[model samples]
Target: MPPTDGPYDGPPAGDRVLALDLGTSSARALVLSADDASPVPGALARHKIAPTYGTGGSATIDLHAYVEGLLGCLDELQHNGHLDGITAIVLSSQWHSIVALDNDGGALTPLITWADTRSVEPRLDPAFDEHAFHARTGAWLHRLYWPRRIPWLLSEVSAVSFAGLPDLVIERLTGDRVTSVSIASGTGSLDLATGEYDAEALAIAGVKPDRLPAIVPSGWTGVLAASYARRWPGLVGVPVHPPTGDGAASNVGSGGYDESTAAVTVGTSAAVRVVHPIDQAPELPWELWRYRVDDQRAVTGMAFSAAGNLHAWLTNVLQLDEAHQEPTDVEIGSSRVIAIPFQAGTRPPETVPGGSGVYFGLSFDDDAADLLAASLQGASLEIDRGLRMLDTLFGRELEVVLGGGGIDASAWWRRCLTATFARPTDVCAEAEVGARGAAAVALGLAPVPGGEHLKPAAPEVERIELLRPRYTILRDLAVQAAQELTRYTSG
Candidate 1:
């Protein structure tokens, strides 16, 4: 197939790339130009396509729901004539989800997502040695990721055989089973040292050698389905260049791609990421992820499943029990309650669910609203714990480049983070950075004006809040609580 060409250098004004972000709660698409650092909301588009969650570790969504939502929105946008100069399409998908399909392009199984914990065993497969697996894949093992679920699909659905998740999605769209290095690295199968599927991991899963998608550079070209594009009206021939996972893209979008920068994103999950020497592949307790959108550079990341979601629980508590229609900072110190944030699977050693919030201290003098405020304080404190572990992983306190759904709005939360981190948090004003970064990936590849190219706008600091530790005792207690939780689980 001939390469789809537009701006491989830098693009002129109005030449656009549409970046798609496939997330847990919704799907968003943004059209970006190499011309601007700040986002024009008018150029962005979004849809609320919710995935159905099963309580029994089977978090799945209809493959059609995502496709329909994407095309429908694009169709509306194009009908409104917004894609005039759009040149390419790039995407970032949530990590660890699996979409199973048969040979004829039919979805044979649900999208067993990162959230699903079913089909996993308590112990590592006799075939999988944890140390050797880590040496090969640089990923921590858990039931939530592809390492376990792919095997489950093979054994349980004996009647229908399909390749891994990305393979099926790419195959469905482009008639080829291809995956980019960025997404593949997030799965438990890829060998970190070699950047390919770990032979030992694949063998245990009973997967065919050809079943996996061929890994390629994130920006490599592949044919997108004209049929779906026609359904989307003006989307015909939209170039599909893959972007790294949302976590990785957010880092790039916020200028955290290299070692000089680091970030803490508070979203449905809280994550601390840093760029570190890849060859070392330090055997730290935190996750070690690859950051290469191309072969140029790589980074390591640590994911905190409880980051932003912890705040959500606090909000619910405030709204329901405390009678406070809105949450505030002053309520935090007066509240004085601590919360345990174990909503999702712990990032490493164990990825099983069952860690829900537990209140540690409370008195009759304190109202439910007060406890709610204290818990939020404690959650920010937990962010400190995660960041410290991240710091230890990199062997230094990293520079903070912060952004996410949580701090994007909610003034109270922003104040909380500023108060917690002692350092001014750099919140990127560009709202949907994952998609915007993906679009920048496209712009990086597009041709430049005057035969010269453009650069991804270096993330600028919108605002900074210095969250000096007002109560060291409070933060210390929270750290001790996290340590206790860690000890309990390790034992």
Candidate 2:
């Protein structure tokens, strides 16, 4: 059980909204002002969760333990009196996770997260038109979504229904087995046009419509289930809003709510997203995905499998000391090493089948710090690529807002990203942007202002630009190497 903290001060209890953030590694509960969606002082609780990893690229969480951790957050909040005067409960959860459910709604399998890569490529049928699928569903025939994962799970276990983590949590809390459009869109099975599950994707996943949770509009609300109502009497009648994908919520939380602004989030993974009204959204790009903020708006972006996780792996592998672990001011492109920072596999537009991390141009003089610096540069370059794609789609430069724990903790990383993008970026200072975003959605508020501003020096920006061509060449070579290696290994 994680500890709970604060009931300090701020808005009146009646004017606060409770936001629950279900992240990849932890669950958090925070109270926010209903007026502006800012977090209430001293009203927060958190619990960490550890996912089980296997040698074969399997990543799973015990469904019971995961849910219990979330419930524990609520327990601590209620015990500390942080639940009082809450108007509604809103959730922000990671996207692209699923679990099997028995007929009675009990979990039949462990929660399979987006990080899991056991469902390999070639799982889809050869006849499936991936491009058409991407255009219709706003997703790819990748292993991260239900199209591949559902069939993979069915080969080993029997299930009557399928649901993502948020759907399951909603069922546990509100006794409503429903998934919001925002959450459903991440499943690679939803038809963006119809705002419902796609029949073709369902056929690919080998599941019928009846086996999935009912799709609901974002901001859909329900009261707590009888058991939970009794456990926390104060929350009994409080409406619980179904979960929104944390990526979309983070954009709103960080003040990137429209087409003119782009949100770049670097957590366990990294992505660049922009929200646009449904009617105004451009044609779906094959390299990116489009998910809903709600029924009225859509978020379009490309996700990279590497980011903070790649940094963590480099630090662990190099055994860097504390000082070296904290990135500092390094001359742009000084490391003289090119890194394909795919400690995890690739994401869309560059989905190399058996991709692994590669360090090109390593020399004997390069130390742990040099390798770490090069890896960070590599990750920044990837994000910059995504941002450029988005800028092209929008046909103009978009204001960039940076959020997530990775950016909040490191000024050096922030500088690297700003230089990479060669633009002035706003750093969202709020430590829990996902939770704040959920509260914002619930309260129908605009983005809150006030965070550090970063403007890149021309010298640094020019230096980074010089390195892009070399990085691109090395990246292509690394992808080709991985493809050849995959073919040889399988044969």
Weakest ten-residue segment in model 2 by summed lDDT: 1-10
Error in Å for residue 348 of model 1: 2.2
In candidate 2, what are the lDDT values of residues 250-358, reduced to their tens digit? 9889888999999998888888999898775698878889988877888999888888777777788878777888556467666788888877778865667534889
Q: Model 1 off-target regions past 4 Å?
A: 1-14, 36-38, 122-128, 159-169, 232-234, 276-292, 317-326, 329-334, 445-491
lDDT for each residue of candidate 1 in 316-383, tens digit (9 for 90 to 100) = 75566334523653533344455555555456653334455556567787765566565556566656
Best by lDDT: 2
Per-model CA lDDT versus the true structure = 0.60, 0.83
Shift in Å, residue 260, candidate 2: 0.4
What are the RMSD figures for all models against the true structure? 6.4, 4.6
Clashing pairs in 2: none
Model 2 regions lying over 4 Å from their true place: 1-14, 120-127, 353-355
Q: What are the TM-scores, per candidate, against the unseen true structure?
A: 0.82, 0.94
> Model 2, 451: alpha-carbon shift in Å?
0.5
Tell me the lDDT of candidate 2: 0.83
